[model samples]
Target chain A: MRSLVQALGLALSDYRHEALFSACSVFVLAAVLAPLMVLLGVRNGVISAMTDRLLRDPRTLEIIPVGSGKYSPEWFRELAARPETAFVVPQTRSIAATISLTNPNRPNLGLNVTRIVATAPGDPLLERYGLPEAGFVRDEKSADPLYPAPLVIVSASVARKLAVPASPQELKDPAGYWLEGRVERVLQGRREAAGINLRVAAVLPPEALGVDAVFVPLEALAAAEDYRDGKNAPLFRALAAPRAEKRSEKAVTPENFEDYSASLYREREYASFRLYARSLDAVEPLWKWLAAREVEVYVKVEEIEAVKSLDHAFSVIFGLITGAALFGFAASTAGNALAGVRRKSRSLGLMRLLGFPGAGIVLFPVVQSLLTAFSGAMLADLLYLIVAFAIDSLFSASLPGKAAVCSLSPGQTLAVFAAVLAVSALSSVAAARQAADIEPSEVLRDV
Target chain B: MAAPAPIVLALRGLRKDRRTERAEHYSLSVPALDVRLGEKILISGPSGAGKSTFLDMAAMALKPDAADEFFFFPGARAGDGRACDIAAAWTRKDIERLAMWRKHIGYVLQTGGLLPFLSAEDNIRVPSKLLGLSAQKDKTARMAARLKISGLLKKFPAQLSVGERQRVAIARALAADPPLVLADEPLASLDPENARTVLDMFMDNIEDAGTTLIVVSHATDLMENMDFRRLILETGARDGKAFAVLKEGPG
Candidate 1:
């Protein structure tokens, strides 16, 4: 220990004169690792953020057809009866005729595609998708009086695009425009799902429901589509009833009555069945089972896995790049350390003649190199932090916010530091060979 | 007085070679000789009489071109295959024999081979440091003072006048207080006054310490008044013959 300290002292006392070389070594080491550290941190932060959003939302379990399919509603209900089932809901897509107030004299000409997601009353999945309450929208009389309009939930962007230009107060009047609809809700938190307006609801976070899809009742959507043909498909009538009623109380039923009589109906119109599951873990199995039961289904389990794997891949890639950078830094530091020792051969000879052992002589350069490397690492870390913050401020993106929290685990940092120090120290050892063989006879020679 | 115990440093059957007086000749037939401690020995002869060769052999710094022969010097113990530690003569295990040997032995020549980088004091301290001598600082300061080089301790060899450099070399040779000091030609690079002063310092200190001194010089007149045993080498027909003279007292 004493010998090691003595060697370190010598190196420190003498190496100060070579400021440029020492500084260059430090900069080289830091340059190699700083970029890797920042990139890894940023990648980790973004991936974690995405994963957190995905995990916070409830996973979709099963999807049932309310418009066209080979299976009757009874089949869907029967499949939903499995012990592994979570929630079974009917869904469909349709286009609704949109009228422009400025051009109302011509006719309601604009048509927009919409997703009609039908849920049973108090369905847990309704909250999962950030949907409005079942009775949030009520029937309202129109100015024309001839055509009664169904309640509609429009995306905020769609609302703006469809509504005629008006002052803020006038825009809020609800009846100022011919397409006047109640401002039931405003979606927040996610940009992708913004600009959506629910009749009596606030907008859902964009990440929760995705793009601005218009929401309408299943029966309403089915009725709207009935104009395409003389009669609506039996699958629609079977799955779009707003309420469930007993067969004994029904005056009439669809042609597939015998095939789906036992199926429950909801709101005396569209029917809904609650799929009870023993546990959340079994939801996927239930989905697959229903899918095999001649029912069209959508599985959310795969979606969650997809999001998880994507985040994992991001982290892995960052790690690989960081590892490569650290390796390169280690190599550079090692080379510099070795060269520094080689350059001091004569100085080392003097020490040996002064009675220092081989190991003692080697210790000076090793300790010196390690000290330089550590100081470089600290400087690099500080500079990287500043850069991260600067980037965040320059762009109004989420990058800056996430960068502030970018950090590596203590174990990882220590491992990297240890590796760098070891490599540098070893390089110095390699250069100490010349010092190991000094002959005492040199001091007695004439010159 | 009873015969003093012989302080023998013998070179048994030592031989040399020459072919028509050529430098690279490898033939051998020279006679062996012995040296005693406390004796100031000189090998005076013509240029080709092998005076330097004999000195090199006696100092153990060089080997003969060809020969397998027995050898003995002042400090070689029985069964010992190596030279003695002249520097740290008192410390055996503490100071390695080879290191002490190198440190203690001092050699000077006509060209003044004092290290160019060091001052006179540092050059003298070099052997002490190598021998692990703890009293080097005191010894170096004292030697520099004794040689009147106290003020010149920081001056480099190149900065010193020729005579001053020779004196510094002499001071360095004596700084470690070694048992054996060898001078190929101590006065070769100095003026008469400086050579006399330096020779006086060497003789005065050598007598005080009873240390062995061997000098190879061509100036027989300068050596006339010195109290040293002279060995004159005869050339050609009698190349190996060495005649010894003891100036001490009826020896």
Candidate 2:
């Protein structure tokens, strides 16, 4: 190790001997590189910001089945276990997924039919809608004893439908209105079903849920489907009424009677599911994965394309600048190093005459060239950081807490370093050749 | 009787051809010669007689055109007493091994060949640094002191007088304790008085180090009293090519 250091010390001394020349070269390279660094940093930051914004959009990662398809219970479990699946909730067929909601306190409001969607914790839309983290339960069947009624979160439209023509008490806080869900079966032109009283835990704003719907937990949606399909819902006593009463007595029978039906209905297989990818980048892979598994899905292909095109545009701009800078640097460095060879021929010949091998003589110029380039690149990166920080600070006043407008990722930073190394090495080729070809005896003849 | 020293260098039937402006080309031939350890030899020749070419061949800088035997046994590298076949290394184009062998030889240029960028001290330390001679860490100081150029150690070669430059070059040659030192007209650019001073100091240092010295010079009258084996190159021209053959001469 010491011997290698001793050998390298000579080259270092050569660099130190002409410190002014070296410093000048370093300054030239730094001046050339600083603007390029800024350009790349800005490109990286803007593209990253665009990608992140698209990724944050809930629909960007949504995967909906093309048509109704039966998904077995095991399919959902496996899909949930996949690394790409962020959240999934199996949905019942749309025909049986509707329920009429009413505000019990306001008898004047009529029944308003609303679609009920399957929801669970970590639903992106709900998460972005700022769902209160604590009160929401993923399964209504497993709800704590304190909250017995089935809980549902209503959309702004649904809330307005149930709260409008507001009673005196509801006019103050309409979003927290109590709701009752009624499932009815008309037989012989008479409505003969009971109402299942439900509570509206929270109402999402219009930005999150544009349509009038009730966000029912997955288990609750399944139970509702079961009750409507002639299956016994043991917990949903209002919908579990016996359907076998004689025709004459049916009219007099009371609603909400829990005489369990003996027959069972086919259940648990869902028509489709609402699935989200773990990330924006995972969307395509997950889509492809589902397609490969014969599960046809509909994704936001055009939206994803728009996001990718942003990266493509940045790449084009970066490529142009990189090509021009690469050529400029290569030409400048080759010219500089080759000129030094001519200027220092006598010195090089002396080294050759002093018993240094051809390789050492070659390294004499290359080492100095690399030193200048390396130092110059370091300075440029430092300058870029200062400039980026200044630019980002300006953004802090306007778009506070958002991503910076000028920054480079670690990979981008490494690319800059690698570019400098490759260019420096390529530029010193002519100088190294000239230095190696110098004959030791040339010193004698030239003297 | 004292034990005889090992041969430091040996050559036989060696020849080199160089293109020259003075003629279409010039050829140098040395039939046979053996240099022992700690011995000194001098070659005096007329201008254009290829004296520098001989020095070049000895320094391993110029590959000879033809040779029967070309060898160097420097007695360097601590205790590894191996004879280096110069001809084989040249034929194999093994530049690394050639450089290793060159570490044992120090060449002094006609104009002191010190790098203009390095200080006088750095110039003298070049050989030791290149050869990684840690044992001779203070050789630059001792050599500068002996040459009386300690005051100029911090000055670059361009800042030194012609005499001071030559002194620095000599110190550089001896810095690594090379077994062989080849001086090519070390006093060529010096005046008579400065030449005498540099040459005397150079010789005293070589003798003190007990190293072999091979000097090529044209100043025959200046070295009239110096004792050494003498050789001369007889220069001639035929068919636009001047040829020189090595021959013995009285010292």
Candidate 3:
């Protein structure tokens, strides 16, 4: 161990003594290494940005079932229970799950039909837009409560149609807007419509959906479908039960109405539901799972795959370039090290004569190569930093606040430096062999 | 200390074959030789007479073509000494084992083989450091002072004069307190005054340590008056092969 340290110190001294020659070698190494570093940084930067763009849009993780299909409650429960499933909720047929809205206080605003999308507590779309989730909540804000059922959250498109020239009080808090929600259908070739008072809870941005739409609790969509299909709605039927007998019409009050609405029409299967996967990696498995059951979904798999393939292509290209560079550099360094041993044969022979072991002599070149390559790596790191800073400064506007377009993470930088040293040591294999072949007698007889 | 061994090195029937630059076969042989502890010997020969070859053999850097017996005992006392079979190590190509014995022997090259990268003091300390001698620090300083090279200790080999480099090489050899020291033309590259000065100081230091010495040189007149065991290589050509044999030379 002491001999090894001595060898290392001797190597350092030798390298310093021949500073100009060593500098030339280090420059050549850094010249090759710096470009490869820049390439790797760019690869990481571009791939990270592409991946972040994909991840930022939650729709990329969504897996929507196509059209209408019989989705069992157990199936939905399983889907929701899946490790890949981020969120899942049962839905109804599109035709039956809709409503027409109008402000009852203003005659100017007319009723308009809007599709009702089934949403639950973990609806990604509503949450992404900073809107309230569709679920039951206490109405402490209202003096005279309208209903205790799920509140209606509308998109900006529908909210605009239902909005009247608001009074000052209405403008201050528009979530209290009362809209008369009516569901219409034709049963037995006759048109029948049922009206219900709906309160606006939150208005989602149009980015959620362009056309008029309403996000309601999954139960609300189920009840709407049942009422339109001529099935019994617990809330609507309870209200109409006393009317046919001319009994007291005020039997259903706001506090007791929740008990009536909670008893929704129960079904084993649903027509549609909102679903999402936990991550991009989860989407393929979830998509494959549904496809195995003959359920086709309208997921953003192709876009996700596009980004992933781009990442793969960049990685392959980077690997090829970096591999070629490292191999070439190692080869060149080996050749140079062999030549260096030959040039310094006399000095090396002197050390051998001084009782320095053959192994110590071998390590002499290895330690020198490490010193040279480590210096080169430092220069490469400096060059990479400058290039990355220049790239980020030049292209900052390309990704906005998303990410830097040309930079390496700290871990990657360290890996690159370590690889440089390892390869440098490996390059000295030939030199070590040459050093071992040197005899102490070379100095005596050469003269 | 135990009683000193009478014989420090023994060799018999040592021979080597070589090819000259003109493609002529040449041979050098040593019949039988033994040196006692504290003995100083001079090997004088003409140019191309195999004096360096003899030193190379003693240094264990050149493998002998054939050897009936070749052994070196570093420690003169029985308790601390063991016979080192240099011939057997050479036959087996056991370089590590041979390198281990180099600790007790020092070889001074003809051209002052000093590492150009190291300072004069570091060059002198290398042998002692290689042996892991605990007294290396003080020994190097004392060797440098005795050689009158204390002022030149901080200078690298390239920065010093030829005479100074030779002195440093001599100090490097003696600093480790080896039992035997071999020098090949230690004064060949110097003027008369520097040669006399270096040779005298080298002899004085080795004598103080009671180390056996073997000096190979082509200059016999310079050591005409010096009292030492003298051997010389005699060269002759026969049957298209030139041959040299080592034996006692006229004092």
Candidate 3 residue lDDT tens string, A1-447: 676677778988899999999999899888888988898888788766666656645677878788889887668777888999888877788778778877777768765678888887778777665566766543434354464445768777776776732233553374566666677766666666766665667777666678888787766677678667666442332222222322332344456645544433233477887888887888989989999989999888678888678767867877898789878877766777777777777777777766677888888988888888889889988998999899988887877454788888889989988888887787686677776665567554574
In order, what DockQ does each candidate have?
A: 0.06, 0.46, 0.63
Top candidate (lDDT): 3
Model 3 per-residue lDDT tens digits across residues B6-93:
7778999999899877438989999999987888899987788788888888888788899999999887633355789999998898
Which parts of model 1 have CA positions greater than 4 angstroms off? A1-13, A16-324, A353-355, A374-397, A400-413, A438-447, B1-140, B143-251
Off by over 4 Å in 3: A51-63, A80-89, A99-111, A118-141, A144-268, A275-292, A297-316, A443-447, B1-5, B77-79
True contacts kept of each: 0.02, 0.50, 0.58
Highest-TM-score candidate:
3
Clash totals for all models, in order? Answer: 34, 0, 1
lDDT score for candidate 2 against the true structure: 0.75
* lDDT (Cα, tens digit) per residue for candidate 1, span A1-447: 444455565667555645677777788878876786677666555555555545433543334343444334655556566666555554432222121121242245342433444445445545654454442232233322322233434444444445433233443456533343221111132111101122323233334455444444444344333322223222222212222222333342345433332332332223333343433346567656756754454556676577657667866877788778867876777778777766665556445443345666677677678777887777677777776676546643644233334555667567657776777777767766544544422222333
Candidates 1 and 3, the one with greater lDDT: 3
- Model 1 preserves the real interface contacts to a fraction of 0.02
Model 2 per-residue lDDT tens digits across residues B42-129: 8988987889888888888878899889999877324456788998888887755776678788888888578777788877777887
